[model samples]
Target chain A: MKIVVCAKYVPDATGDRKFNADNTVDRVGVDGVLSELDEYAVEEALQIRDATDGEVVVVTVGPEVARAAVLKSLQMGADSGVHVLDEAIHGSDSAATSLILARAVERQRPDLVLCGMASTDGGMSVVPAMLAERLGLPQVTFASEVVVEDTTVRIRRDGDAATEVIEATTPLILSVTDQCNEPRYPSFKGIMAAKKKPVETLTLGDLGIAADQVGLDAAWTRVDGFTERLPKSAGTVVTDDNGSGADQLVSFLVSQKFV
Target chain B: MSEILVLVDHADGSVRKTTAELLTFARRLGTPSAVFIGAGIESARDALRQYGAERVYVVDSPDVGDYLVAPKAEALAQLVQRTGPAAVLLPSNAEGKEIAGRLAIKTASGLITDAVDVTPADGGVAATQSVFAGSYTVNSAVTHGTPIVTIKPNSTTPEAVEGSAVEERVDVTISELAKTARVVERKPREATGRPELTEAAIVVSGGRGTGGNFEPVEQFADTLGAAVGASRAAVDSGWYPHAYQIGQTGKTVSPQLYVATGISGAIQHRAGMQTSKTIVAINKDEEAPIFELVDFGVVGDLHTVLPAATAQVQARKG
Candidate 1:
């Protein structure tokens, strides 16, 4: 089996993930980490590769920091990596990002493609679906458990209203949830092996995508304006030493018309 | 007025409240049309009329609902072509967003998800989105093609407005690729009799402080007619089901009122619910970060404070 896992480099969710002056995520100023969610996708792909004795390649579409994401996946057991970096790719929305990934994935010609359910920063969770649409591939997303038997893939999707067991043939797109598997830490030997893994870094010119086709100017959606939310004012806090705390809470709820 | 098409969210033909919310929001932009897929049109017609769906476009084809979201996207794309609608609205659920994403790409339209508000602006519809876990509010509009927006629940108070309720049957040709992922089995979640977590106006959440007991939280939630949620700590510790977990990787809910019990208000937990209009926390630690964001906080054990509050509410209602 030939598998390709999509990886993303996102701002550390724990820190102050601020936006640039242009309203895009400040990928340069902040500490970047391989998105916590993508680790699950990489681990799933690696497991599948191990079971089938096939190759796993990690793909990323971002700026320079995205290269690190690919490296992290390689360290986790991806056989090789592909990084699509271009200056014009900055400020691209999920739609454009999907287009770039589709182009990159088409180049690899893999039998299976995997992605995280959603990125930590944007949290749109739409890219995998968009990419599947562009590629005309069947997509089984939000998989809590994925089983591969021969060329058939079955996934358990834990939705809000129901739990669905979805089945699809290989050459389809699959996105996994955090509960799918516990990702492994990179051993010292694996880290050294990743350094020797082949990584092909390409630009838009190499992929036949024009600069005008992407970037902020070609975006279908525009952020007209934005505002930072004001810090919540300090709230009232009362001790329960007298056991009147519940009454005070009731009174507050009444005032807010919530009771 | 041009049509603002809304994909009706439903189960077994019973329309969900989010569909009414979408219709009410659509009225602000243009004519509201309900795109109903699969069975149960008779059961849903009144609700559609009550919420002001001027035209109810029915796609009764089993092909759309039998498969995953791709076929639904195909069906909507055909409707967009036929109606030349000004915009489209869908519930911001997993399936809805996927359909919207595919539709946007198919029709070359702009897509926005998790919009808190949508109103007419600059000759088109502009959506207000609470981003970065509600720390920032941004207003955006589709600059290219028709605006396809997925809205969150409880963003606006749905009002009843009777409409023409004309019905139109739509026929769509589903592609072979859209039929590849087949749902082999489906098990509906057991009913809790509480409101859906994301759609609930009020949510009561428990955390590590519950000590593996959710009785107080459930009792309080039932008393208030609110939904029950849980922090990751509670879910990870096997105190609560993972479906009820509310955090960065879990569900994001913006309710009118949110009550956190025994939660320390970690950033992950806050990201799931910080947009709530009013917040209240019950924790033993007065210094818990949850207190900083709450409108009112009680420094006490939830075991004691919640049961007392539940009884007090029942007495007041009586």
Candidate 2:
């Protein structure tokens, strides 16, 4: 059995996430790293493969720097990596991303496909569902816990109103949340092993995709404009020096009609 | 009139407040047409009518009610083809986002999720998104087919307005592929008699300062009839269940009032509630980083501040 892990390199959430001249995220100026959330998906994939004695292949599609995403997964115990880098892939929306990812995942036929619940940058949390629709497979997303037995896969989804247990078979897409498992750090030996592992690079042409079908020019959504939110005013601050802190807060709430 | 399709979000034949919020917001673009895809239209009709629903399309299909979101997406795809609405509006929950995602592909439309506001633009509906932990405000629009947008709850006040709410029953042929994944079991959270966090007007949250005790936080929330929430730190430390965790991965709440007790206000936690109309914090540390952004602050221990404040509020009410 083979499992494919879909990973992404996102702008660091701690940095000042800014927009470029073209309204795209400023990935160049800000430090980029493998999305912290995707680490759980990579870990879950590795565990499933270790249990089943299969190969774990990591796939990513983005700018050239996105190869780091694949490399990070490789260092964490993946067998190989595939980076889909192309100049035409910039500013792709979730729809375009699902298209590219669906093609890249199709290039590597696997029993299971896994992805993080959402990227910290885009944070749309819609790509996995769209990819499932594009790939014509069942998708069990937002899995807090996953257990696999033979060909059956079950996941516990913690939603807003309820916690549901969903079941599906192989040949499907699964997205794991941060609660799934703890992501392991790459040991020195694992890093050395990852250096020798095969890392293949592909372009839009290699995946049978047209340049006109991607990038900002072909995106379905357009950014009209943006503005920096004005800094909020610091209305009041009261210390507990006189034991009147709670009373002050209640008075403020009363003035605001919250009491 | 250009029609805007609003998908009803319901549970066990009861409509959720998010649906009312969605319908109220959808009216800004065009005439609001609700798409009810389960067995609860009868119970939801009055609320829908009260919220200015000009037309209500119903599909009480078992295949859709029993399965995950894919079947509903398929059913919506057929509806979009038949009605050709100006835009599709759905609640920005997990299920609603997934449905809009698949429906975007099936209808060849642009998908925007977690939009805080939507309005009519020149070519299409413009969505206002709060990005980068509420640092930037972005205005976006769909450039492709029908615009599909998922709106976050508490985006706007749900105002009651009379409407025809003329009902229409439609049949959608759901494909077998959509029903592949099955919901084997459901364990709904036990009733707390509190408002849902995301849709609440007021929310009081606690963090590491609680030291595994949420009684004070719950008591304060109960006094004000507000919802209860916990920071990711509290949940990860086993102080609270994951269901009530509020952070970047957990629920993002934009309520009218947000009070953080004992939380140091990490960037992740700030992202979840930064857009709140009024922010207040109570912490022992004066420089807890949460103070810089809050509208009001009290420098003291949460255990002492919250209970005292709760009592004062109760006294004021009496």
Candidate 3:
């Protein structure tokens, strides 16, 4: 079994975010790490690789700096990495991004493709579904647990109020939810071995995909202007006057029509 | 004189509010035509007509509805090829985003997801995206095939324009290749009697300070007909479902009013709900980060604050 795991390098969600003069994100100073959710995708791919005896290939599309993300995944026990780097690939929306990824997956021809439910930076959980559509494959988005047995994969999807079991055949795509599994940490040995692992670099042309087909120029949408969030006026902070705290709270609640 | 294809996001042919909103946005760029991908087209026709869809392209194929997004994309791709619409408008939900992505590639068109607004520009739809956590607004136009845009819910108020929408049955054959994966079974969510989160006018979310006690938070949410959300900490602590997490790592939601209880607003959490029109926070700590972005703040124990508020709302209704 062959598995392709799509990963992204995004700003550490916990890092301080700064905006550039143009109002785009100042990603340079921020720590660019593997997306937290993508880790689970990588981990889930490894789990499947372990269970099925196959190679786990990590793929990402970004600038030259994106090599670090692929390397990190390699460090975390992936067998290999593929980086699709092109300046023209900059600012591709979910649709364009999925196109690039689908081309990469087409090049690899994997039996299964896995992705995190959404990227931490964009939080647009649209890629997998789009990829599934582009690849013309079955996709189970937001899968909590996926167990591959024989030729079919049994998945548990966490719905609003219930858990659902869905079954899909092989050569499928899954956008794994965080509930899938606790991702494994990169062990010291794995990290060191990753340095020696081969990470293949491919340009958009190398994948037989035209860069002109994606990127900011071909992107369907754009951002016009952005404003910082409006500062909220502080709400009333009615402190307790000894035992009268509850009464004051009730009065305040009544005033707000809450309760 | 190209038409705009609006994908009707509905359940059992009951059009969703976002559908109306999409039609409202679609009409801005081109003539509005609805693409209903479901089993019940006859039941959906009246509402589709009411929302200014000049034509209803009905694909009442169970094969399209039985599976997930792939087949729907195939069906929409066919519609796009047939109508040569000026643009395609889909609700910016998870499924809609996927459909937009697939349809974009199939038609070799430019696709944009999470557009806050859409307008007519340069003989095409100009879409704006709130990017970089709403720090930058990007105005973009698809230069490739027909522009495919998915607008987020609540991005605009839907104004209905009653039209003589003629229903047309679009003959679509789902490609066997499209059904590469099938939904062997579907488990609809146990009805959470509350309103949908994105469409809800009010939302109440709990943060780490809740310490696993969501009783007051749920009660307050129930009182105001708001959807309940949790911060990553609360969800990580097993206090709530991960789906209810509102953060950079969770579902992004923008409502008219957002109430945070027992939450110290982390930037990641704020990324999810910062676009809300009004924000109120109740925290015991006066300096909790959640208060920084709130329109209203109450420095009190949420346990004390929320129940009182809930009771008041209940009494007001009584």
User: Which has the greatest DockQ?
Assistant: 2
Candidate 1: the clashing residue pairs are none
Q: Which parts of model 2 have CA positions greater than 4 angstroms off?
A: none
lDDT of 1 by residue, A1-259 (tens): 9999999999888887788778788887888999999999999999999999999999998898778999999999999999999999998988999999999998889889999989988888899899999999999999999999999999999887889999999898999998899899999989999999999998998888999999888899998778999999989998886669999999999998877
For each candidate, the alpha-carbon lDDT, in order, equals 0.92, 0.91, 0.79
| lDDT tens per residue, model 2, A34-148 | 9989999999999999999998999998887888888899999999999998989999889998999999999788889999988988788999999999999999999999999
In model 3, what is chain B's TM-score? 0.95
Q: After aligning candidate 1 to the native by TM-score, how far in Å is the CA of A228 from where it should be?
A: 0.6
| Residue ranges of candidate 3 with Cα displaced over 4 Å | A16-29, A91-96, A158-165, A210-215, A218-259
Output the better candidate (2/3) by lDDT: 2
How displaced is residue A75 in candidate 3, in Å?
2.6
Question: In candidate 2, how many Å is residue A154 off?
Answer: 0.7
lDDT of 3 by residue, A1-259 (tens): 8999999988776776565564445556777888888999999999999999999999998877778889889988999999988878876767778878999988888988999988877777778877877776778878888889867987877653345666778788988888888888889999999999988888888877786877766676554445554355655555543424445555554555544
Instruction: Name the DockQ score for candidate 3.
Output: 0.50
What's the DockQ of model 1? 0.80
Evaluate residue B288 in candidate 3 and report its C-alpha lDDT on the 0 to 100 scale: 81
Q: What TM-score results for chain B in every one of the models?
A: 0.98, 0.98, 0.95
lDDT of 1: 0.92
